[model samples]
Target: MTFNLETERLILRDLRMSDLEGMFELDSDPEVHKYLGNKPVKTKEESQKIIEAVIDQYEKYGIGRWALINKKTGEFMGWSGLKLNTKMNGITNFYDVGYRLIKRFWGQGYATESGKKAVDYGFKVLKLPELYGITEMEHQASHHALLKIGLKYIEDFYFEEEKIKLRWYKIENK
Candidate 1:
């Protein structure tokens, strides 16, 4: 299934093969992945595989991370949307909201903007009971954005798989 969502200055849409370059640029940057295990993709093929995996999620789950595009410049800023995070860190599978933008676009409020929209989509459109956001404990920027988008910090716990402590945030549809 195909999807598109718009905010005041961004367009969130399904990932496509044409997004390879933008995805590579976003994923290859060490700064961009600093809070994400600090492991940047080494090749364009890796980015291609990431896109393919998201596409498969769209088919299987009806939702996944959407490409974040600058509506005005038509630039691919990165991606932000909802994902069904299946059992990881001993946490049961749950719907989560996430975002990633180019380092250049880091401080422009794009993450919170798109994240709020994703939360809306999750609750109103998908009818999910709750949504979550997880970030490395030191990622204050992401922590702030998640709060700004309405998620409240619930706990800090160790993710055995990554061997890192993470902050888990959540928001529920009342």
Candidate 2:
């Protein structure tokens, strides 16, 4: 079944082929990719592939990041939710809470709001023991949102593959 969730002003649901336009709008912006490897998607096909990958994750792992939509405006804002991360950061088979919003939606508290819902789902609904978050070390906005959603700063680690340092955060199911 497709995942669906609601907050005060947003609706979180499974990513679909229909979201290609919005996905492209969100991922093709250079500003949105500044902290995310400085690589914004150059074409709509790349955005299509991304949505496909997330759809595959749902079929394989039973969970994946969901599309974030404005409840009132019916606008596709971006995506947020939990993903099963494997063999990243020396951790295996763990849940990661993440979010990305359209640039215009930034600073509007959407990240923090949706992140909290993802954490709650991981702990309460999925019965996960812990959840993790990774952000570029210099991303102050993400740092604030992760912390606000109750994740504690763990440490900075260098990702050998990406050749960049990142900050790790975590929250236990306690």
Candidate 3:
């Protein structure tokens, strides 16, 4: 399969080693990570490791989170894609849609747009029966984004490692 998927305003591709700085800016924003770990990444080095791990996941899994770049300016806006994370509960434990955008990119409709494309990729193209998504129970924005992308609220659950009340949503191919 190709390493990238393109949308009208975004290019969703696998992260490269050179994307560390952009990744740092995206992952290290406190507000962006608020519903995530409730902490910024702390350093550029941590972003580098994350990029490397994402690359590794692509190599092994064939599908992984993708870096979202603004096609017009070639700027890294954020990332949105699919992953098979077993960590989230009350779901099938496979094929989840996820996104993390820089603070500056918030409220631009990018997350919902990319999420719609990712869900299409997962269900229409990837031929999965359904795709799951998780968000912190308090993350109204993420919950809104997921709903905008056609996912229905499934249930509330907990992930031990994240220690956050989570809600799961699913988009069915049917």
Candidate 4:
């Protein structure tokens, strides 16, 4: 499936192999992976593998994270979109809204902007009943972004797979 979602200053679209360089830059930063278990990929090949996985997800689940681009500069800032999270933290088959931009893009309100768009797409476009956002407890920026985008803090729980405590946030269509 092809997707093209545009916001005021950003564009969300399907991931492509050509985005490898930007994906490498975004995933290689240790700072960017601090909340992601500090597992910064060691090689561009690893980043390529991640891209492959996301592509597979797109084919398998019909929805996955999208490539986030700056409309003004046309740069691959990072990725932000929805994923069909089949199982995580005891939840099953949930639609998850998430974002991750390069450190340079951090603190620029991109997360909130993309997140709100993702949530709207889930509810309005996909007609999902609800959407979820998960973040590490200390990732205050993500926490604030989720809330800023209208997800309510639901609870705190241990993510066994990631081996970390996470804050769960959700918003339902009403």
Alpha carbon lDDT of each predicted model: 0.94, 0.95, 0.85, 0.93
> Mind sharing the TM-score for model 3?
0.93
* Model 1 lDDT, full chain set: 0.94
Give the poorly placed runs of model 2, Cα more than 4 Å off. none
lDDT of 3 by residue, 1-174 (tens): 356778888998887877888899988888888889677888999898888788878787778888899989999888899997765474445899999998888888898999999988887777999888889999998999999999999898877877888898988898
Per-model C-alpha RMSD: 0.8, 0.7, 1.5, 0.8
* Per-residue C-alpha lDDT of model 4 across residues 1-174, encoded as one tens digit per residue: 688999999999999999999999999999999999999988999999999999999899888999999999999999999999889878899999999999999999999999999998988988999999999999999999999999999999998888988999999998
Report the lDDT tens digits of candidate 1 across residue range 131-160: 889999999999999999999999999888
lDDT of 3: 0.85
Query: Which ranges of candidate 1 are over 4 A from the true structure?
Result: none
Error of 3 at 51 (Å): 0.7
Candidate 1 versus truth, CA RMSD in Å, comes to 0.8
- C-alpha positional error of residue 144 in candidate 3 after TM-score superposition, expressed in Å: 0.7
Candidate 4, pairs of clashing residues: none
Question: For every model shown, what is its TM-score relative to the native structure?
Answer: 0.98, 0.98, 0.93, 0.97
Residues 99-162, candidate 2, lDDT per residue (tens digit)?
9999999999999999999998888888999999999999999999999999999999999988
Report the number of the highest-lDDT candidate: 2
